[model samples]
Structures are given as structure tokens and as C-alpha cells.
Target: MKCHRCGREIPEGDNYMHLGETLCEDCYLDIRMAVKACDPWAVHSATRFREGSGHKGTEGLTDLQKEIYELVKGKGKVRKEEVIENLNLSEQEMQRQLATLRHCELIKGRKEGDKVYLILYR
Candidate 1:
């Protein structure tokens, strides 16, 4: 690949820039830093740096577990049976997902009045 700005051949694994047009790795970083430093407060006020992990860690969850996660997230708190009905999953599958999420520390809660309310972990 060629850097559109410098017309230099871009090496493998080299940073590719997308500043109106593609640029070399070094030039791209320089431009990015310049823009960021131009207004330090604008960049620093976010309180934290967020980056995409690309569902890498999420791959550990099974299909049922992912469904349960989404269900709990949407509903706030749900009983074990509600999940089964909403997801059309077997009791065994629901229990499996619940166990996986609990083991992974992704959720926390207990039972009350024969109903199990699952609280999602942030």
C-alpha cells in the first residue's frame, strides 16, 4: 500500500492514516497528536479512554449466555422462568447461562419469594 500524502509505500503492519486522505504512519500520528494537543482540555475532559475490544472477551460466552445477558440487560431484573419463556430456551439452558454469567462475575443477585431476581454487573 502507498501513503497517499507522501506517495511512500506503506509497510506491513504500519499505521495507516485517514486524514481527509490516507497518510504514512509517522505523519498520521503527528497529525493526530497535533490536533489533540491543539485543545488539551477538549481531549482530556473525557475522564477515561475508551477502546473497542472487538468482542474478544465476549466470545467466551455461549449463545444461551449471550441471550441471557441481553435479556437481563433489557429487562433490568428477571426471574429464571421469565427468561425461559422470553427466550424459548429450556430450563437447563437457562440454568447453564445463569451459571456461566454468575461464574464470570457478570451478574449478581439471589432469590426472593420463589423468584430469582438477577442484577446485571456493570
Candidate 2:
């Protein structure tokens, strides 16, 4: 079978049905288990991991994370839709990356009237 989301071929037993769509394992997990940016424990753990590993600034981050940080830093502020469009990212994937960036305290969200913007934390 093929995954409805990414059009990837699914192995016999590795397909998942979500919201009436057949998805491969990765796509299924993307929709079902988005990481949250507001979990205090997550922030603490990410901080300790960075400190323990002596990582500074964007050090130790994934390439995608660094790219996201750079985009936000360069733009000053951006909407979620803009990031997704500019990076060609799925909403679920974008949320996961954003959550990680937030846990590292590299980015934050601000509400401006009816819309929210992503910006550097400091």
C-alpha cells in the first residue's frame, strides 16, 4: 500500500490508518505525536543536555534546527504559515522543529492582534 500523505510505499505491516487515511509509520507518527513547546520538563531537559554537552548558541543542533533559527533571526519575526511556506515543510514537521527550538529557548511566539508571530527569544 501507499501512504496517503507522502505517497511513499508502505510495507505490508507497517501502515497505519489515521483519520481515514493510510499512512506510513513516519507520517503516522508525525500527525499523532507532535512535540509540545510548552512543557516545562522538556525545556529543563533540553537545557541540561545542552549545558552538559557544552553546546553554545546553535551548536549541537540539527541542520534543520539551525536553518529555522537563522530564518527567524534574519526575519526578526515570522508567522507560522510563512515559515512553513518558505521552508517547504509540513505543518506537523514544522511544529516538531519549532517545539525543539522553543525548548532550547532560541525562539518564542508572540500574539499580535489576530495573528501569532515567531521571534527570537532574546
**What lDDT is obtained when candidate 1 is compared to the true structure?**
0.63
RMSD of each: 17.4, 5.9
Q: What lDDT does the true structure give each of the candidates? A: 0.63, 0.81
| TM values, all candidates | 0.48, 0.58
Residue ranges of candidate 2 with Cα displaced over 4 Å: 1-56
Q: Which whole-number lDDT from 0 to 100 does residue 51 have in model 1? A: 28
The superposed Cα distance between candidate 1 and the true structure at residue 102, in angstroms, equals 0.6
lDDT digits (tens) for residues 54-104 of candidate 1? 342234455766778877878888777788898898764565566556655
Q: Show model 1 residue runs off by greater than 4 Å.
A: 1-57, 112-114
lDDT of 2 by residue, 88-121 (tens): 9989788888867776788899999999999999
- The deviation in Å at residue 79 for candidate 1 is 1.1
C-alpha lDDT of residue 7 in model 2:
97
Error of 2 at 52 (Å): 15
lDDT of predicted model 2: 0.81
